[model samples]
Target: MIVGVTGGIGSGKSTVVNFFLELGNIAFYHADIEAKNIINSSVKVKTKIEAFFGKEAYKDNVLNKKYISNIVFHNPESLKQLNAIVHPEVKKHFKNFVNQHKNKEYILYENAILFETKSHHTCDFIISVYCDLKTRISRIKNRDNISENAILDRINNQWKEDKKLLQSNYLITNFAQIETKNQVNHIHNILTKKRKLI
Candidate 1:
């Protein structure tokens, strides 16, 4: 089975997924982190991004994240074009990763935009994490050290919570660490039992 965990910015999907990571027999794929790595390490990807976004896209072999984020967050077309360059490579990487770990109980695919990228279709189950708006905003502000407008821009780029919940097989309301970990343990037990019957 392939299980996915996703949520909007600051929704604590990472914190929840970390608990799942502690469980046995489940491989993990962190899409955004891999995508960033691919963009940084692959010469083909570097050339493509530089060609479209210009040399400013990178500085001394590292992605100029602020430069790219500023452009893509404000311009939908730029974001689409950027995804077009990076996603295919990440998909290929993920395919290899899944094959390597196919014998495991399941793969945990963690992504912030799993549904937006239509990657949820590849999952056997999905957990959507959510928190109150104020909590999310505060978390992002503290973690990312960005202004509210920039944080909201990232949030707005994602699908609404209502739509995500509609698509999810599980929902995790991540308000506190202990509560979140308990939910993860509950889900992990359920998934463990689920695999046995398969």
Candidate 2:
């Protein structure tokens, strides 16, 4: 089974993915991390990004993430262009990852923009991690060291959590660690049983 996990910025999606990891049977593919790797290592991606954003898109062959982020967050078109260039390659990489882990009962594909990119269509099930707006803003403020307004801008760029919630097969409330774990355990048990029937 392929499970897609997603949530907005600072919603503790990583924590939930980690809990899934701790269950010991799941293979995990973090799309954000893999996207960064593809952006840096794939010559085709690097060339396209350079063409779109100019030479400064990279510094000594490494991605100028801050420079890119500033441009994309403020300009929706530029962000869309960037995603257009990167997401397809990320999807290809994800396919290969799934092939490698085909023996696992299930694998987790975690992406912050799973729904926005329509990547969840590739999954057998989807999970959304949700937390209140106040908590999300505070968490991002502490974690990313960015201004609240800037964080809000990033958050606003993604689909609202309520919309994602309606589409998800499972929802995990992340405000409390204990509750989160319990929910993960319940989902894991359910998926394991489903996998057996498959």
Candidate 3:
């Protein structure tokens, strides 16, 4: 089984994925990290990004994230172009990952843009992690040292939480006030049982 886990910025999706990892049977593929790696390592991706964004897109063969982020967040067309270049490669990488983990009962494909990139179609189940907007803003502010407006811009760029919830097979609320571990364990047990019947 392939479970696609997603959440908006600062929704604690990584923490939830960690809890799922603690259960000891699931293989995990983090798409965001893989996307970064692909952009840095894949010649096709590098050429396309540079062609679109110019040489400033990278610094000494490494991605200039600040440069890229500035362009994408403020310009929807640029963001769409960037996604167009990167997502297909990320999807290919994910398929290779899933194939390698086929022996596992299930695997977790954690992505921030699962729905936007249409990767959810590859999932047997989708788990969305949600949290209040205020909490999300505060967490990102502290973690990314980003301004409130910038964080809000990034958040606004993604699908809204309520809309994402409608598409989810399961929802994990990751508010600080709630015990997320129990929720993860509950879902983990359910997934394990479901995998057996497959």
Candidate 1 residue-wise lDDT, 1-198, digit = tens: 889999988999889878888888779899999999999999999999999999999999999999999999999889989988998898889989998997998899998999888889888899999998999999999998999999999888889999999999999999989999999999999998998888
State the displacement of the C-alpha of residue 52, model 3, in Å, after optimal TM-score superposition: 0.8
CA lDDT scores, all candidates in order: 0.92, 0.93, 0.92
lDDT of 3: 0.92
Across 1-198, the per-residue lDDT of candidate 3 in tens digits comes to 999999999999999998889886789999999999999999999999999999999999999999999999999899999999999999888888888998887999999989998889999999999988989998998999989999988998899888899999999999753489999889999989999899
RMSD of 2: 0.9
Q: State every prediction's TM-score relative to the real structure.
A: 0.96, 0.97, 0.97
lDDT of 1: 0.92
Which candidate number has the best lDDT?
2
Off by over 4 Å in 1: none
